[model samples]
Target: MKRILIILQKEFIQIFRNKTILPIIFVLPIVQLLILANAATQEMKSIRLAIVDSDHSPESRSLINAFSHSKFYTHIPVEGGVNVSIEQIDFGKADAVILIPKGFGEYLIEGTPVNVQLMLNAINITSAALTHSYTSGIIQNFASSIGMETINVTSSKPSIRHWYNPELNYKLYMVPGILVVLVTIVGMFLTAINIVREKELGTIEQVNVTPIKPYQFIVGKLVPFWIIALIELSFGLIIAKIVFNLTIVGSIPLLFGFAALYLIVALGLGLILSTSASNQQQVMFMVFFFMIVFLMLSGLFTPTESMPQWAVLFNKINPLYYFMKVNRMLILKGSEFSNLWDSFVAISIIALLTIFVAIKRYHKSV
Candidate 1:
């Protein structure tokens, strides 16, 4: 027991004295929380809305005014055909393009329906859809207003209610996902290379030659990193709550429990990598590659259900996917273990398997 404690003390002191790693462990998570949370918003605001006015008449001017008056849109005039404005939208020069046909005013006066083309950049599907829906509502209101003034006719009623996110605030949706990303990056990148770094510095050989058992060495090495990772996790969640005004609609204790399980899986996977690889570079490359692949498929940025069936199959093997789901479920859905047990069991099995393989590999190498 004393020897194990001594190993822990030695490992902790060494890690604490490493100036390069402390900043990354303590400073980077907060920085990413601040910068990414600010940039990764879902709310569509001041979108560049361009107009092609072929009619060039009072009604066209009215249509332009309709778009300009809306808080969501920033209207810009395009001096060409609808196609030209659409190209601008395609190239990301504009978010949306509204076109008024040549006979817009004449047709309105003649009681003939005039066609208006709305071209939107669907790259950001949520924002583009909202912009189109809001623009359509404005146009429908204008049409009804014109009908009431120029003709006596019943207008089609328009009613809108946004679901889930009533305010459509991007921060609310992104905060949970951002926290998942930070956890994965730190876990996969830092943890995987821990032992490999010792090997590079010749300390792994020194430890192997010592009286310390593999279990003692492994536990001692992992304890500090595990604590550091959890600390970063806590910092991220606290910032999410205080800075972004995010809520923990789910059980906070349950969330941390699942997080603990997920961390074991992360650390185990890293142990496996470090055991198999002889040097730090190989560990870094492999860990980075896996982290990228997992993060991309984890639905941190996109919905997993929206992916293709085959891609969803790949997501099943991804530990980060389960972590992402658990984080969001706890933060947004208020989920308990019953809602996340299947994922928990799978990750637990994986963790055990990796740890077993890692120990075996380390034994063979030593």
Candidate 2:
């Protein structure tokens, strides 16, 4: 008890006093939370759309008005006329082009099919998808409104519903996802390199030769990190609530429970890496490689369903994927344990595996 207490006090003092890391410990997560959360979003807004109103009639004006009124488009003027050449859309000068062919009003009055070309930039797949969805929605609504006003056709009214995020504000979806990233950084990167730093500085050897148990040493190192992580998480959540107006639909206690589980798994992963690494650089690189894979696989930026079947299967086993899912569920969907059994089960399994690996490696070292 005395040895563990002494080691804990030493670790705490080192952490609080370290000139290089103390500032990072206090500021890095907050900065990342503010910047990345704001930047990372599923919805693409303010798309630069080129207008080619060749018709120059009331009908074309109305169609253009529809886009302008919506939150999606920022209409850009064409040089020659409203109908910009194909070159304009192709060269990435425009995200989308609304081309109203000549005599569009004649076709509208005659009830004839008018070809309105919507050229979209497909290079940015996400922006393209949003553009397509927005354009399609606008056209669908226009057709329906026209049909309802002009001709009474006995057709069923389409009911549109959005899953997960109904309003699709973007920030609501990103806040929780960013929290997952902060957790990974604090638990894996910080702890992994810290352990290796002690090893490199010859401090670990001095401690290792003492009467302290390996578990005691590991726990003493881990506890301070865990406390610091909790503090960071609190600050993150508070910021999320204030700046982003993020919603926590699930129980706060439940979120903390899952966070605790995730922290255990993360610490174990860090310990495994720390035990195996010969130096801090190696630990950092190894953990970074793993983190990249984990972040990409997590369904934060894109739908997990959109990934290739093999990648989807691989993501099922990814710990960060589960963490991301849990956070989204808690924040957006108000998901309970009953609503998230699959994610809970997967996270639990991963936590066990990491702990087992870490313990095995630690014992081997001792």
Q: Backbone collision count in every prediction?
A: 2, 3
Q: How many angstroms is residue 48 displaced in model 2 relative to the true structure, after the best TM-score fit?
A: 3.3
Q: Across residues 284-361, which tens digit of lDDT does each residue of candidate 2 receive? A: 989998898889988878788889999899997788888898888888888878988777777888888887777667
What would the per-residue lDDT of candidate 1 be over residues 292-332, giving only the tens digit for each residue? 88888998788899999988998777888998988887888
Span of ten consecutive residues with least summed lDDT in model 1:
148-157
| Displacement of the residue 171 alpha carbon in candidate 1, Å | 3.2
The TM-score obtained by model 1 is: 0.75
lDDT of each: 0.77, 0.78
RMSD of model 2 against the true structure: 4.3
Q: Highest TM-score: give the candidate number.
A: 2
Q: Model 2 — which ten-residue stretch has the worst lDDT?
A: 148-157
Runs off by more than 4 Å, candidate 2: 1-6, 38-43, 50-60, 77-93, 99-117, 142-161, 166-171, 364-366
Clash pairs, model 2 backbone: 52-82, 52-83, 53-82
Q: List candidate 1 segments past 4 Å from native.
A: 48-70, 75-126, 133-163, 364-366
